[model samples]
Structures are given as structure tokens and as C-alpha cells.
Target: MSVFNSSRLAGKTVLITGASAGIGAATAVLFARAGSNIVLAARRVDTLKAVAEHCTAAHKQSGVQAGGKFAVVQLDVADKKQVAGLFDQIPAELKDIDILVNNAGFVLGVEKIGDIAESDVEAMFAVNVLGLISVTQLLVRHFKAKNSGHVINLGSVAGREPYANGGIYCATKHAVKSFTGSLIRELVNTKIRVSEVQPGMVETEFSIVRFRGDKSAADKVYEGLQPLVAEDVAEEIVWVASRPPHVNIAEVFVMPVNQASAGISYREPKV
Candidate 1:
């Protein structure tokens, strides 16, 4: 149950986006335990440091000889220039990333496509779609040069099954899913691998962001259900990246037992 006794990541470097909180943070820690050097990117420098500490502590406990180092970068994936600059600063040792997790994203208030604010739509695309694509392009170039790497893109069930009030968010994730398929096709003969993880409903800051800090509203989203936690999704990501290079799990969809699809889940009455 402690961080020590975990599998050694063994000489792999992983660069994760949106790692300041939620799934990104959880995945960073998991990779750290596997002994992978962690390069965390996020907008919050303080939060990034906290995450790095968790990774470092876990590394020490694991007795894996510190297979890799931990580094943090304040990055806003939404900006093209910032994303480019972040990649350029990859530490020499960690430059050859074994894995890249594109986990930066946000959700505005739910609304019909026609009722969605243009700003919300633009922001979502900027981070979810443009940002994810930009980071992948840069990493692909790196992987192509190195002749090996794994890319794990975070998507949502909403991407696969559109929801009434989730128009814009669904649209962005749908783009990600499509891009993952196309990009993998383009790299068919290369050593680089592309994959996407589509999660149904998980308890995290997602609904908080969607409701703009409406705790009551966010709580309701996960009420009466054992929703997926951040680590649950992160575990899948780490496992996919840990697989042999010869085997690339292209797509993985995770959901809570009570949930079957996007926004379709069994809910019990509050006791």
C-alpha cells in the first residue's frame, strides 16, 4: 500500500500535460512509482511542485535506484508558442521521452451547440483540440527521430457518444479521437505508437470546471455512484505505456460499473 514495492519504470522519461491536478497529477505519480523520470507540465507552478514532491517521495520509497528524475514546467497548452517552448526545454536526459500524456483540458457550462458561448467554444478547442494536437506533433517528431515512443491522449466517452448539453466538449473530444486514429495510421511503419483513452464518468474536477466552481452541482454529477477516480484512469495510461514496444494498445475505454456510456449511469437515492 506504500509507494515502495512498486514496479520500476526503469530508465523511461514521461512528459505529461495538465499535470497540476486531477488525472494529470495522479498519472504523474503513478509513472514515478514505475521508476520513470517525470516531466510535469501545467499552468500552476506551485501545484506542479507538490506533484513533483509526491513523485520524488514515491521514488525514494520504491528502492528502484531512482530510475528517473522529476522535473516540472509551467505550461499553458492552449498557447501554441508556449507549447513549442515547453518541448524545447525538455531536459537532455529526459528529452527522449518514453511516453507523452496529453491530459490538459477544460469544460465550460453545458449547453446546446446553438446556446454555447463562442468564447467557451474557442477556449475548449484551443486547449482540448489545438493544444493536444500541437503537443502530439512535437512529440511525434521527437519519436520519429528516436524511432520509438508512446503517445497517450486523454479523451472522453462524450467524444464517442454525443450528449445534449455537452455539445462543445463532445465536439473537441471527438476531434481528438479522430486525430488519434489518423495519426496512428500515418505512423504505421514507424516505431512511434499512438493511442487514446476514453473515460466515461469519473469523480474529479471535471464537473467543477464545467459548473464554474459550483460544488453542489459538481457533487451531484457523481452522487450515488462509485465513479472512476483519477488514479483509475491513470493506471490504465501507465499500463498502456508500460507494454512492450512491439505491442501498442491503440484504444482503451474505462467506466464505472454503474455507468455504461456517456451520461448514462445508474444512480441510487441519497441515503
Candidate 2:
């Protein structure tokens, strides 16, 4: 039986990076609904605040406010110092965090590998790979000391299969896949649980960022069929975190039915 039960997360504290929008925002709300106190962190303070309010409103509606907790922090995960500082602030608000969702990542520019600028590739690694490693390691150190915690790394299907023009982005995600697997093996005997959630072609600001605000280019990624929504990914995060203490879901990849693989997909417009 799957140990993904809501009651498993009751009274737990969860710190989610990139909670301002996209998959991170969705997971924050889902975790809040499941009775976990939420620490929402993102680069945009206003956006984070709005997400927190939404979670609070949902908790109020369901009569889950008894112990429901939420807070927002403006953070840029790329900064190692800031990442460590943000983790320090977690304990003061909701005590020790039982879950850490390292979902703060973005792709700057999308181009064929040969056409890509050197700086763009560097930025991709700066945020996607290095930032993720720093944040996860910081949390692992904290959790290892206490001997308990769940780390969820947000990866992409592109990690498994490289696409035509998204080489750097795919490389970063591939690193996440490898790093997540390695972390799980290294901490296999410990109480800390590390899991990776790989999502494919979600309708969000992801493509816009990749194309540098080129709406037309961004639209091309989801031209046909119903793409995965942020809420869909968020629900998976909550489920993975809700698993029984003894159960650890190492990796979960969520993609639309139309998306059979990273590069191959059934598009509506026949692009």
C-alpha cells in the first residue's frame, strides 16, 4: 500500500523554495492543506505573500486553521549565503522542518547547444545545479543532525533525454537527476529521505523565461493537448512528502499523457 496519506504530514513543518509561483507555489498550498506549517521562499516577496494568503484562505475554509501555519521569505537560492540564512530562519518560526522542497530554478536562454552563449550556460548551472546542491546540502546537514527530514528535488524529464535547443537546461536537470540519485544512495542508511520529482512541459513561466520573455516561443512548448498544471505538480509534492516515515519514494516523474518522453510528445497543432 502507498504510504502517501495526508495524516502523515499533520503537524509537520515544510520549507519550500521557489514558493512564489509555478510548481513551488502549488506545493506550498498543497502542503498547507495537508496540515503542514509552510515556510514559503522565493525571489519575489510580494508573490510569496500572495501565495501565503491563498494558503491561509484555504485553511480557513476547511477549518484546518487550528495548527495551520504559513510564512513567506524573499530569497534568491543562487546565493549560497542567503540560502544558508534562509534555513536558519526556519527553526524560529515553525521549529525544525520535516520537509525541504528545493524547487527554485530557471533557464535563462534556450538555443541550440552550438549557438548558446557561454554566459547563459553558466547561469543555468549557477541556479539549477549549484544552487540546488547548496540548498539541499544545507538542509541535509540540519536534518542529519536531528536524524529526520525529507528533501524533494524538482527535476525535469529533459534531464533524461536531451532536446534540440534546450541543451544547457537539459544538462542542468540531468545533473539534478544524477545528484538526487547520488544523495539517496549516500544517505540510504540515515533517517533523511531524498526524492526527486521530474515534471515535463508544465504550463508556467518556465518557457517564457527560457525564451527570454518571447511569448511566441514559449507558447510553442505547449501548443497542443492539455499540459500539466502547477497544481498537478504540487499535489505530487504533497503526496511524496506525506509518505510514512519508513517509506521513501526516491524519485517521481510527472508528465501529461501526451508526453511520453522528454523529446517525443503528441502536440495538437502538429508542430
Candidate 3:
């Protein structure tokens, strides 16, 4: 087996959305360690700065040279005006992004169908579907001009299998899956590549956000199972990006061993 060489990522610039924390932040650090310049975009500028610092520290630890610069941008992808002006906000040096990680997304509540809140539905779709599309549209245009780029979207198991109490979120991910498929078909003849990484049972602030800051409730989501962590998914993302240009890793469905589906996980009983 040929050993994967991460050096290929050196000097490449990557733009990541929702990069304030979780998988986005982890991906930034990993890419930085690989000597890639990173543009971290999120609404929380302070948190983005912290992530940038972590990226710098990771690059230093890796001993890589001549790369690993970072820029933090305040972005709320849900806002169309902000998404439209994103590139202008990026540093000129990092404007030519080699990779776009569409990671800015979230879930609001777990209300079942008949009782689902309209506001929650709109909020989830705004960021997860529409916001993702807006960013990708802008980036794909740039990619076409350069004739090269990679769009890596953060999808979820819910995209493949819908679970009760997560209808809207699942629908949004399904839209993402569909959008990724369409993009792959559209870019088949181009050097530009499109990929989706669907992760399952990740133990992140995701659950806390889903539970609206109810830490105790969020904790229960992973009560007795070793769920995947941000690093796990981030490693997969970096690995996907490290592949040779001729190779396209179209889609990756990653889940913890204990997770079989969106709602089906083998969590051990409390002792």
C-alpha cells in the first residue's frame, strides 16, 4: 500500500465555514499541521481566533515550514448578504482557496412532525441547506475559473436515514446529499472535485446545541457509548483532501462502531 503523503496539502489554502469549534476547528488544525493555510469563518470571531491560535500551535508542533498561515472571518452563512461578500472579506493572499469545507450548520430542536415549530424549521434550513448552497455557488464559480478546487460538505447519517423528531434536520441533510450528487455530476468533466463526509454519533457541542444548552440532556445522548469525536471526523476530512488530484473520494459515510443508523446505536446500559 502506498503511504498517504500529507505534504501534498502544503501551501494549499482551505476555507472552512462554522470553524469556531467542533469538526470545523479540528479540521483547521489538522490541515494547518499538514502545512495548509486556513481561513476560519464563523459568527463567533473570538472563538475563531482561539481556533486560529490552535492551528498555529499545531503547525509549529508539526515542524512544517513556509505555510500554515491563518485568517479568521466573522460569517453567519444564514445571511445571504454576508455569504455574497465572503470572498471580499478574505485576505487577498488566501482568496484562491483550494478547498471549501461547508461545515456551517446546526439543529434547533427534536420536536416531532405534528408539533414541530415553524421557526425551528426555517432556522435549520436557512443554515444547513440554503446557506450551504449560497457558499458553494460562489466557490464553484471561482473553482471553474481556476479549473481546480475541492468542495467538502459536512453531511450526517440523518441524510441517509431519517429519524423521528429530526425531520427538518434530516430533510436539510438529504438536500445536502442531493446537492452534492448534482455537483459531482455537473463537475464530472472538470478537475474540480466534490465530496461529502457523513458522520454519525459524534460527541460534540452538536447535541448541546440541539438540546438548547441543556448540558444534562445533551450528556444523555452519549451516556454509555463511545461516540466519534471531532478529531475522528477531521482526520477523515484531511485524508480525503490528501488524495492525489486524479483520485476523487466522492462520499464517505463514517460512524462509530456502535452506531448502525441515525437513531440506532448500541449504548451500554448504565451500570
Candidate 2 overall lDDT versus native: 0.85
Choose the strongest candidate by TM-score. 3
Indicate which candidate wins on lDDT.
3
Per-residue lDDT tens digits for candidate 3, residues 127-173, read 99999999999999999999999999999999999999899999999
Model-by-model lDDT, in order? 0.87, 0.85, 0.93
lDDT for 246 in candidate 1 is 79
Which of 1 and 2 is ahead in TM-score?
A: 1
lDDT of 1 by residue, 1-271 (tens): 5333235357788899999999999999888877889899989989999999998987787677756498888888888899788767777777778789999998999788788889999999999999999999888888999888889999989889998898889999999999999989999999888889999887888899999999999998888889999999998888788776778889999999999988678999867
Q: With candidate 1 superimposed using the best TM-score fit, by how many Å does residue 271's alpha carbon deviate from the native?
A: 4.1
TM-score of each predicted structure versus truth: 0.95, 0.94, 0.98
Ranking by TM-score: 3, 1, 2
C-alpha lDDT of residue 239 in model 2:
87
Candidate 1: deviation at residue 194, Å? 1.1
Candidate 3: TM-score?
0.98
**Given candidate 1, what's the lDDT at residue 159?**
81
What's the lDDT of the predicted structure labeled candidate 1?
Answer: 0.87
Clashing pairs in model 2, backbone N/Cα/C closer than 3 A = none
